[model samples]
Target chain A: MSETTEDIMSATYRALCAHGFADLTMQRIADETDRSKASLHYHYDTKEELLRAFLDYLLDDFESRLACEAADPDERLDTFVEAVFGPAEADDDGDFAVALLEIKARAPFSEPFRDRLVALDARMRETVAAAVRDGIEAGRYAEVDPDDVARFVVTAINGSHVREVALDESPAEARRLVEAYLDRTLDRRSEPEVPV
Target chain B: MSETTEDIMSATYRALCAHGFADLTMQRIADETDRSKASLHYHYDTKEELLRAFLDYLLDDFESRLACEAADPDERLDTFVEAVFGPAEADDDGDFAVALLEIKARAPFSEPFRDRLVALDARMRETVAAAVRDGIEAGRYAEVDPDDVARFVVTAINGSHVREVALDESPAEARRLVEAYLDRTLDRRSEPEVPV
Candidate 1:
């Protein structure tokens, strides 16, 4: 992407975090970026188009960072959980969560957004599943269906985010629950031995 | 409530299910009820007021129904899960879920909406905790922290709703996962025997 394109995307993100999706406008975005509305329109024809691009940018950034941090299977679960529940770089006021919820609310109506979310969810699940599989193979975790465990982990994380945004609550309880789940399900030492 | 109030509320529900929260207008609500715009204004005063009233109505209806169906402790978990994941009364196109997502998205910014959501969540957690306590007392379930389990259950349900809305996907996986959780946590036989 060109410097101008990158600047526009950053401005869009700032505007979204500031004004939210409901009140976001092209003019507002342009003002945030110190560019004319025509310039924004020239880059992206519509608000949905611009936001969709932003989603793509965010997802790509997340996937790449996850790949880098998740190199060790033993630490993958902790890393993934932290990334999902931890504070964002520019999210001191929790505006990132708010903006995410706003865009997510549109997924049911917008096909592109829905597709992107589906892909993101699948990717996250896959990452967890791989970690679980590796743990089991290394005899560090119990032998369970990796896919099922992955889904449960993802669901817990998603639920935590929802609670955090809608109720202005912390994800501590959710984090603890997931940790308990992992301890119970993955720790083979805690399982009863089968009769020989 | 008066018949007039009920009629207006029903009309508002219909309009919301049709046009969603973003496009909802007093004129559209009046059209749905076959009442004049002036009448709607007299009844609701503003769109937010009408929506807040509708939310209260929905919550009251939910609490009453939950009270009726959750009389049996053994059936309480099943009933709550079904209510959260069941088909809606007026949701042939799944618009009920969409409308709910829209309203929930506003909770962070709308004090009335946030208060109502907090109350609803508390009631749900209390119901689950009560059921768990009763189960333990009756020797039907293992002894566990009812509050912790209740929070986990509520979080799973909330997360499933968020996933369902954002991906337009079914909650089957979430349902199965929660069922597994309850089986593991609540079943006495599944618990390891205490050493004498």
Candidate 2:
């Protein structure tokens, strides 16, 4: 992202965190950055436009963030999964998840938002599938269909996160189950030392 | 549900499927039933109120439908899972799922919606847990934490459904993965000969 875009997105993130999705206004978003409302509007005309830009920024940021340097396929997959399930990246207060879910709920009605979300999920699914493919190629894991495994992993995490946001269900249990499933099915080549 | 309530719910279902959630109106709902808009208003003062009632009906309907006559634990568990994953109950075309997602997305902002969604999930979890418990009791499956398994199953289904609604992802793959996990972990005694 350009430096200016990054600055605006960071501010947008803070604004979203503070106001929640339902109450977010472009004015509030502009207030988080050095940009005046006029300047913000100059860059992105409408709140929907700004949000679509934010989603693009999010996709880019996620791709960059998932560039894990783990040594093995299993570990790489674990790291990828941990990026969401782990504390460092989880939307702790659920404000962010709620915000995303709200957007997701409306995606059916908005083509641009729908496209970005689809792209984002595609990235996640492909990244996972790549990791599984590597494991199979290296003979470090079972020869199960990589795409299928990736879909299952992604689906489980998606469900867990949604449940956590919607029902206040503990995501810790999901992490445990997912980890166990991976270890059992993949035959862990690198035992994760991450404490439960 | 009473005859009157069932009539209303069926109408509500048709309206939701036709209009989707965002455009749903009491008038549209009334158009689906014999009841006049005034009569509908007498029953539910607001669209939100009517939706809440519909959710309650859904819960009761779900509970009754899950009284699966499948003889064994594994078959019974499959039956319950099939309620969502199977063709018979799967929300084909996803209009209903999209509507629900819209409601679920706003659940955090509304207590009544949140409570009903939580209750619905709880019922799904407990039903799966009970099936697993029965399986263990009969020594037809390897012992595992029934609640844990139940949560995992529910989470995967939720994720798959959400993905299906939001990303137009296929849910058939999710069912395949979930079934494999259950058969492998639970040691299925009743071999489901259902064609995949």
- TM-score on alpha carbons, each prediction: 0.90, 0.90
Off by over 4 Å in 2: A88-92, A189-196, B87-92, B189-196
- Candidate DockQ values, in order, are 0.75, 0.71
Candidate 1 to truth, TM: 0.90
Give per-residue CA lDDT, model 1, range A83-154, as digits (tens).
Answer: 776667655477777888878888877899888888899999998899989888887888889999998888
Stretches of candidate 1 above 4 Å error? Answer: A68-72, A188-196, B69-72, B188-196
TM-score of 2: 0.90
lDDT of 2 by residue, A161-181 (tens): 688767877788788888877
Which residue pairs show collisions in model 1?
A: none
Error of 2 at A62 (Å): 1.3
Q: Which ten residues in a row have the lowest lDDT in candidate 2 chain A?
A: A85-94
User: What is the interface root-mean-square deviation of candidate 2?
Assistant: 1.2
